[model samples]
Target chain A: MSVKLTEDMLKALPDSRGHFGAFGGRFVSETLMDSLMTLEREYLRLKEDPEFQATFDKDLADYVGRPSPLYFAERLTREAGGAQIWLKREDLNHTGAHKVNNTIGQALLASFLGKKRVIAETGAGQHGVATATVCARLGLECHVFMGSEDVKRQSLNVYRMKLLGATVHSVESGTKTLKDAMNDAMRDWVANVDDTFYIIGTVAGPHPYPLLVRDFQSVIGRELREQSVAQAGRLPDALVACVGGGSNAIGMFYPFLGDESVQLYGVEAGGLGIDSGQHAAPLCAGRPGVLHGNRTYLMEDENGQIAGTHSVSAGLDYPGVGPEHAWLKDIGRANYVSVTDEEALDGFRKLTRIEGIMPALESAHAVAYGLKLAATMDKDQVLVINVSGRGDKDIHTIAQLDGIEI
Target chain B: MSRIEGVLKALKSQGRKALIPFVTAGDPHPDETVALMHALVAAGSDIIELGVPFSDPMADGPVIQLACERALKHGTSLRRVIAMVKEFRETDTETPVVLMGYLNPMEAMGYETFADAAADAGIDGILTVDLPPEEADEVAPLFAARNLDPIFLLAPTTTDERIRAISEHSSGYVYYVSIKGVTGSASIDVDEVARKVAHVHELTALPVGVGFGIRDAETAAAVGRVSDGVIVGSVLVDTIARHQTDPKALHQALTDLLNPMRKALDSLAQ
Candidate 1:
């Protein structure tokens, strides 16, 4: 069953109370409520100001390298013998992922709000590196919270964050992963709300965070709008992107929401299989509940305790997804599916061999689903896949899985 | 009148401050929670705040976090916690029991169902640490219909406008967090707490209870001098953690820990 949405519902979402059709609301403690309201007001003001937009545009162009190429993968299209595949190369950004796009925008907002320090939480550490990079560029003190398990698994990114002059705190709480890291980050924000700004890595969290992040990251979709017209002669017939906390996917899907002809697919990490109960595909399998700060689809047990999630890619190993994605799924604006670890591995290898491009493990989930979807479509159709990040961080894990020591 | 309102009225008439003690249900052991509640009342506790253990407690420090972990290891759930309260009410119906925890477990139970079960189990009040007045529209009406007191937290950094809003939405006494940080954190400034309590009194007539960092009798007494009640949680929970192996010793230690603060609070009322 699909929910029918009015025109106003799609354009003016979240209303004034930060609710996206009961999926998103401020579910934080009273201490953090004031700060969130303040941030919401400031973000609303800055999003419409031309000066702020100008600064954001200039940073995207010169600092982080915007308008990344929309490349046609001829060999992969030929090998699949299906729809022609186009890649949005977000991997070539400054910090090597689509995460920096929002961080740059938020870091600028933090400066404009006169906050001297910024804090973030990370799972695979891509977000930590991106936040540290922007904070370093803007001359702000940065703190990144990572789970102790992730700190060990992604040690190189930990060092990279430190090299950029950001302090890294290893959270030793529940599950010791992305969820715990986000909890600790919220705790830190509550404690230091006077001088600190929290730069959430994804389009999740309470209220204005989802709205603000989508607006900042919508630059990807805006650029795609222009690029698709110029390069592909029109909008692609379909769009595909991986969903962790759903930032990159929402960024790629927001501008195309009104394009009824373009089909959207969001691929989630199917760690083992749907029946195995080890996947992080919340939208595909989980139920709606309150977690973190918002009411969204969450992987939780019967008693409402957040269940431990498994994904070969650390970035996608989260229990809850962004609330807007939950809304989109409910309203039938987008389709959500999953790809198993082995399928993603196959995608990684096929992209590397056929197109000479190394896709991140997180983005490989999208590639896997895209190939499957393309094979079922006509050969003349166009499918655009978001290469959300580079694969440099996953080399060690991939090598270990392949029975090689590096 | 409700047990909570009655207790506050009696305490005020007797020129005494309320001594509220917090303990996680099923901590140390699942079967001993009722006996612990009785022991707390015997140790001069005016109200009992029973913690429903959750996997993630963002506002809590190491001590309370460890308490929740120990309770969860015993497979404690919100339903079991309510049953414990029901068991406690069988022997003693005078002492008001407040259920306190995060919002997820109750949310999973559904607002109307949880509220009916909680009232049926003889629960007097509830304080969800993460649910502010802004997000209480769904659950607050159900609580009011059941005549359950909906308590809220007021931090040191809360603004005047928000304080007024919280005062309107809240039914039971407002919990004033003594410090800006999480529970069990150190460095409590008594004068600052007094000023904030005075400001809170100016906004609302509801009784204000100071909590979060009152570990010893001295701090409890100092806080008691300004607020209507002093809530001690981490110190008592830490005592339970220390005597996890010996239930008898745990009971004695909890009583011993609360007796002095109880005496100190009484002397302050004098």
Candidate 2:
């Protein structure tokens, strides 16, 4: 059931410690040389230090509400015509999204470094809300860069962030959206690397981020495994998670990467269809290129400028994914697949109507896969998935699009 | 052959380094754009990287970003940068002029069309920061058709495998970043830079010109001692922006930075 590759197996590489299976490596500008070196030193110490994990573990439990529930979705499983399905409800956590888990860990770590301000950029507003929530709790000065378009679409989220006491900047340049927001955040980081901590939300940035964000989000997999093994009396047959910058997917997949029996599937948003220009499935359609912080699969133009992307879920409406996932797709370690906007919309309706659960549109991609894959499998097979966030934030857009069609 | 190969050819025969100077087109004012190019070549710049201003530059640091913002505010576009290149090429055809910029405007104008315009405008090379070597086919094929050098960045963090990868497809000299972060920070470890430059040299005879954190004339001198070229960015921009209202201070600072490094590289051959 495991796909374990010993650390000694990877020792031949120059950056064995940095690479994960075939993923993760430093790809950044020279300005961050000393800073990255400093971080590498600090992270190396923290990796081996029990006290550091102990502190993080305490924050996960006491502060962020850890060990999120894994509940059986009996009705939805029956409707999908497959084995019993279970959901690791990360949405039920504080901030109504799994992003809180990473935010709390990073904000705490920022405090450990005596950093006074925490800065970030958000696309869908979930990460911004989570970061702002943590900053409010920790009393750190929080500045969030949001795209002007995102501010308009996710008005509730924008207001929520402002209510949480974050200084929100609406970026007006470069498509006025997530990628632009990220550029603004990077600019801010470049200017304030001295006293501020850049709390990146996803696993997409240069080296340490893909690694760190995964480590922070791995609690979902860890808890799901512990609870499922205890109740189901065995590990689940497969682990499924949605990929947006691939952070949540990496989190859930990291704890189970060695478990070969636990097949992993990363579902991407196929906005109209893979053939349509509107999709956000970078791994499926995009070629390898550098974006944000590192080289990865990105939706780029002939001139390599990041092109516009579309998804039913604002969060998954990105042009690139983390490089680790890029490597994972290459190695065929984890299958990267897509769920069309229509398919995800159906999943959204099924979860709400059958299981009495409303999933964030981003999470609906995984749910869409669950429904499709369930029909092909035997009834005895069990599947576990991450219900990454709640649907409250997505309702306005869904309403605007008018409930699921076909 | 790439224009960079010509510079490397000269360096090999003359036993000299490529002194590359980057100046923003339409910076301070649109008229100064071509004038600065002529002044830089006269000041001993072996290659001139003329930056085309983009509204959003995620990869640039504060200094270059600000320079770009100022350039953009003045309506500096690819067309204007090409015009500057054409004007400069009239007087200085030997010195290579590389148009360094983000990818949006190029795509906005269409790559094939942009390449033709650039070639007609006498531009020799282009360096798009966002376009990694892995995806050079995005625009490189078109640029190659027009005989334009496609410059790429290889940072200190780039592995030997990556350097080989970058060098295989990269035309022009590799823009070797001496540090790990953004554009302008402070004091670099020259010993570490020497080690990284040696590593970069192993992959390609394509002259590796080091940039980022080489801010002062002293630091430029230090870099010129080890590498084929030294790129001074923030210090130059700061000097220019400091006396935006007065051109004399800008000239004074430019002379201050380029003179000592010119002397150091001159002494290197002796």
Candidate 1 retains true contacts at a fraction of 0.61
Docking class of 1: medium
Misplaced by over 4 Å in model 1 are: A1-7
Number of residue pairs clashing in candidate 1, backbone atoms closer than 3 angstroms, sequence gap of 3 or more or interchain: 0
Clashing pairs in 1: none
Candidates' chain B TM-scores in the order shown: 0.99, 0.95
Tell me the tens digit of each residue's lDDT in model 2 across A360-396.
9999999999888877777888888789999998888
Best by TM-score: 1
TM-score per prediction, in order, is: 0.98, 0.71
lDDT per residue (tens digit) for residues B1-270 in model 2: 766688778786888877788877778778787877776776777888888876557767667777887886677777777878888878877888888887656766777888999999888888887666543555878888888988888875566776887788877788987765567855689999998898788778788889888765677778887788888677777777887777766676677777776777777777
